[model samples]
Target chain A: MKDNKPEWYARMKRGPFEVTKFDSEMMRKVEERALIDRIKPRKKRFSPWAAAVATAIVLIGVYFLVPKSSLSYPDTQEVGAGKSEMTAEYVREHLKIGMAQEDVKNIFGNAAEGQSVKRDFAQPHQDDPNDMRTWTAVDIWRYDYGVGEGYSVHSDLEKDNGFDMPGIENGNIESQLVIVWKDNKVERAFYKYMSSKGLESTQIGPAIEDFPDTEPPISDEAKHDSEYPSLEVRAIGESTLGKFELRPRKGSAEKIQPLGAPSCLGLDTDLTITGDYELFFKATAGGESLIQNYEALEIIQKENKAIMMQKFDFPKVELYLFIPRYTDCHGLEFYAYGIDKKTGEASAFTFQEGDNAIPYWTTSPMVLPTQLDDQLVVEGGRFAGTDGATRYRFQPDLNKHQMMLEGKEQIP
Target chain B: MLTRDYLKYVSDIPTATLQELMEEHGQEVWNYAYFLTKNVDMSDDIAQDVFLRAFLHIASFRGQSTVRTWLFSITRNTAINYRKNAFFRKVTLLEWIHSASSASSAEEQYMSRTFTDTIWQLVLKLPPKYREVLVLDAKYELPLSEIASLLRVSSGTVKSRLHRARSKMKEFMKEVERREG
Candidate 1:
């Protein structure tokens, strides 16, 4: 009993319980509810039989809708030999998160110049090799589909979110289809779909449709289910209208605002337990917002920076809210909660003041991975600004708990 | 691979083939939830929620992870969230803790009775995080790295937590000895 190891751990306990019969009745109810809940006005127009019939008939019609470009290469060779041409609907439904770039181009047509990673750079990557950091080059492709017209990533946008362009100049990311490519395959894709068009205000959530991960669609599950013909989309591709500038202004350090809106990457709360109970938050606000989230014993801003870190250790373990003042959007948004490489001391990634009118900026939600170095180091993130986007890394000092960073890269 | 007839039924309700696939699976899930919560009602609720998630998100299952592993991950998340609720926290687990064993054989019943009474008593005393890692690691044999990914922490963090959890259990065992000494 007094020893460090307990006998009960080795006492050979009974394994998990075994149930002979499953509650099929309950599962049936849940399945029925899921199916019934899917009924809506947009989809209601097409009866199940009609949808299946229409889909079968529309293959030829949709193939003609493919956007063709001069720079395109013929990819019809790879179109599942003997399979019919894929419609944009088939493309959207079949495309998975980590899909091939060739498959994307295979389904959609050749990407236009402005819609791809090979856009004519002011400093063409080959022209200026000195300034560029080492990168595991990822080709980014953008697509835009419309109501009157159809899908085209290179379509001239009245207002771009500045999402795809190298620098943050002028644009809003409204209905932007982004696919990140690494080693010539899809690394991660972020497709936004407007959820509710009925309301004056719209909410964009992650598009759920994707090419089913690497597992080949061996099952005729797709073929068998005619009722669930289309991807379950409420309001698919309605582009957003209004926009906001991320440009910085003078006295920007003092006038802080929430990163985006509360719902959109502006604030996130997580529950963590180490030896203590903590509800950690990664947000872009300051002072009172810190107190509102957690009962704070101490709220300190590292080295007079606007970022505040609150520590709570009551019901055991911990919860911290790292709130930074990203008041003016354009200039600053990078923050980190990591330890210092030199002193073995931890650092808080707080916000900084910046100049306004810098158009090049990324709209990445401010988040610090729980395992900072591991996640980011493997899947590298971007440190962007109006000047141009660049590769960023969090090199942890082998000293175990600390890390190294470039200027303004480390949170305060 | 020849698609099994069960696989054929799997596409209809998303629940049909699962109902068959999970006949053996449900017991493991129910038992894991019971061990974690030490409460049958909550375990039942958590197990149901786990299966429901599996059913709804079946389309997202790319066979990246085995269905068993995925089910457990969902189970662990659901149980942790369930345990954290203020209502569940305030309620007593004492009643269910007493009702742990009902084996038929005399010697089997005696061993299980003592095992549930002593070992589980100490296990239940550990913190939620410790209880989770210990059950997953020592019980379920989940590797530390897998535990780390499941909990969304670093492998280093998971290693540290597992070490501390066992050490805490040792300390709890000592406290129990001191009480009945």
Candidate 2:
């Protein structure tokens, strides 16, 4: 046993042991026709119990399909509202990375508006539209008043940081505004209200840097005409991985501070923006917070402007949401955003009910998939504030929803 | 499509043809089992089990990897599971000690048998993972790439395991020489 250069170990280096002629012959005999012939053949058997169960299942299915107006029903108004709340919960769950554009429009409805700003990297000058040498940066922000909430392409930064401020708690409504900066100047602003109609009514600001040589010499007319005065208080951009909040300065025109700025957005100070910028805002009622959970926000900066991409990659699971009959079910979907820790490449996936169905249902309460395995590292969880709460929030005890991960199975 | 001729064609094919066509590689499978069980008879049994299981599941096989790699994977699993079973544990331990003592006595009677017996005993002393990689390369003639794929590890892992196995085996052999002398 003490021999270091054992013959077997040395032989193992050359390759597996050679099959001696006797060994091959012995194998042939043991594995030959007689063994194959001895294998027992299977036969199908009919069972009365199985037949009875199948019949009962078919009858129950027929009973649910039959329309019965005679059955006593709850009032439509209450039911409709309940259904809307459930639908909102469904949208929160089942959000995957790389969701399609059509799926977003379907969920939020056509009443939403989409806006974009392009930052050119080549021209360095704001006037050059066709600077071939510059990278064209685009930020598309969509707004939907009918859904009572809207989302911009880049405003999810706060949601990704575990700060569900305006949606969950009251009194902290002051921390719901977000500011977008380009080249270190305040470019755009977004805000969310705690009310059901959170972002329905908001104001827009003109370019602040456009005006020059008017320090401490402000007239009422100049304040009205300047874009700086018109800036709307908005939530800072939340990517799939990051969250930000911006609050306008109180009683002063020159100093606006970002709510929850340094810790949440990694910004040094609040009201500092020097170059051209674009900002978008999104607000929803009684859904999960986009903070707390792991998420990825991909920011692709091409010259002066940056495009922020969010990817939500929740595990494949079944989500049930109640929605009004009038609203399209097809629109109800989830988008997943994944942010690569090393390369900041954010990807998004939109999951639909018809395509991605829950394979089975269980009565056990739901839990985050990350807790089940140590190896599964959720990228956004580290920045999800101190409490490590879920990114999506839901109404208390009102919306009855189910979310489940589908078991892995081989594709047939 | 179901015809007598088709049945005859399948039946006429020799059973050895079934095993060969089934891609049941015998030598590699046996060598890998030997690495685990360290007993020639038990290794042969494990190799047979691997081939039989492969034959039964051949229809489900999709050619993702080579037939040799797949067969060796089955052999490794079969050998490991056999070693884990309570009955196999008791029997294998008893048999290992008995065989080692007997072989040692036999070597005393015949000096010529000492080298081979001593080498195999030292191989059994190496750690399980290292011994496995060495056996796969030396006895079975499997390439490092195929072994890496079979083990579901990086190529560097296979090389490192082999290196460790060689060093450990060498150390064991040196100790044996000192004790015997």
Candidate 3:
């Protein structure tokens, strides 16, 4: 205990620290003086002159930025033509069944054969049955100048022992096709070519009628399993500039497939089925029904056959529905169902009218339970003094579903 | 409620009773600031600012950490801010010692002391992470756990850093010893 080790331990021990001698008395007095310098409250201040100057500057800026150059002196002019004008590019883009008379002429230059034909409008009349108008004139164009001749012109004639001219193997001529239009609608079309049998003629009726019905050359089970079940709502096997990812909602019973090719109708095939399925399409935002743009969807069976079950052309004001295998479809309500007399493809469905679907503004705002009931009763101050106050009162017709909000003040 | 009596209550208590018992121990706090800044005036200013800020936000202080740890935390932040502001104008501890010694010829500059000069040169060369804990431990005699809290690191990490720092210092000292020999 009395060794050099004990002495060394004591020397290495942390030293006895001394206290700080800071004089904080002066600092305390300074803080008291600063607090005493503060005073009482004052009235609200106004700067009307500054506000007026800001307003004038904003108006001047707007005038320079958005000046009117149209007939309406102080108002901005509406952009683009009001009516939908069909152009050659638009024809190539949409590629609908019919093309106007002027468009065909512009595309083909001149018709090889021009003729007049009268046809009746057999579709249902809107108001007057006798109001049907008949179309009289139609034109057609064709080309048939040794089309394959250019490819074989330099080939040796002696090789095949004088086979009918170097390019003329089986009398297939190079030619341009022409379409005929009557009263702004395609009535007929045909191809022109040099025929040894003095211009062999082939008539191209209405583009839709001449769509080459080959009986599909496939079985019904093969079509249903491969093609019939597949919905070809739009252009199939056509090139789309891009692809998109589709994410199904959480806990949804339906299994979603990858987005397939877009059809001429503009709908993309998004699912294939083993069991029954119901597809729901809701607008991304709320607006008038006429403003809702059309989307196409197609379903193809395993053997590569398909059908367009739902085609959206009319104004979609409310909800749209489509049920595959309509005979198996139980609930029949509003909208019409197509019963293919040849195939018996029928389904019962309904399309509700008016603003029936849940609008994004209402459903999205009330996340908590209390917010929901408060939204339904129109009691929350959140919607006060706005268009939402009135709009919230009109509950969307969601098949009689209701939501309750908790812990919120009631709207008067 | 705070008045002259409160100030005296804090001040009149004997230095040993207040210095060892008080959480912040202002003398040691000021010394730490002084070492970082190498200026007595700035150190005093920083110490006063730390106390004022601490007093104002005292209600928010939950006493989860020791008073010394808290004060050092404030001192470190304030000193760093001051250094950043005066980045272009810097004065080394050796220069400061030289100036102080020049004013009073009786004392020699710490840089002139061979052992002190060697240690100072090696400490300055250390990375900021190791150097901070080393200076606080060696110069201010702060506990390793308290230094760890001030640096917001684990005590084991502080111990490892101190060990590495000492190893580096020993290596430097050995080189100096060789040169002198």
TM-score of each: 0.33, 0.31, 0.26
Estimate, for each residue in A287-347, the C-alpha lDDT of model 2 and write its tens digit: 2223212111111111112222222233431112111011110111122333333333322
Model 1 residue runs over 4 Å out of place are A1-7, A15-412, B1-16, B35-38, B80-117
DockQ of each: 0.05, 0.05, 0.02
TM-scores of chain A in all candidate models? 0.24, 0.17, 0.17
How high is the DockQ of candidate 2?
0.05
Ranking by DockQ: 2, 1, 3
Docking category of candidate 1: incorrect
lDDT for A221 in candidate 1 is: 25
| Candidate 1 structure quality by residue, lDDT tens digits, A1-412 | 1224345655424543223223655455445544543342222345667865775565456557655431122243322222223232233444554445654665555532233323344532232111111222335555432211221233332222213321111222233344555566664443443323210111111223221232222223223334222211101111011111111122221111111112111221211111111223222232111111111112111122222333322121122223332222222222233322232223233222121121112223333323232323211233221223333443333333222333224231
In candidate 3, which residue ranges exceed 4 Å CA deviation? A1-412, B1-24, B86-127, B137-146, B154-157, B175-181
lDDT of 2: 0.38
- Compared with the true structure, what per-residue lDDT tens digits does model 2 show for residues B1-181? 1111222223133465555633445655665676677656567567766665555555434444455665666776666555543335555556546655565434223422322444655665676777777766666657766776666544544665676577667656656676787
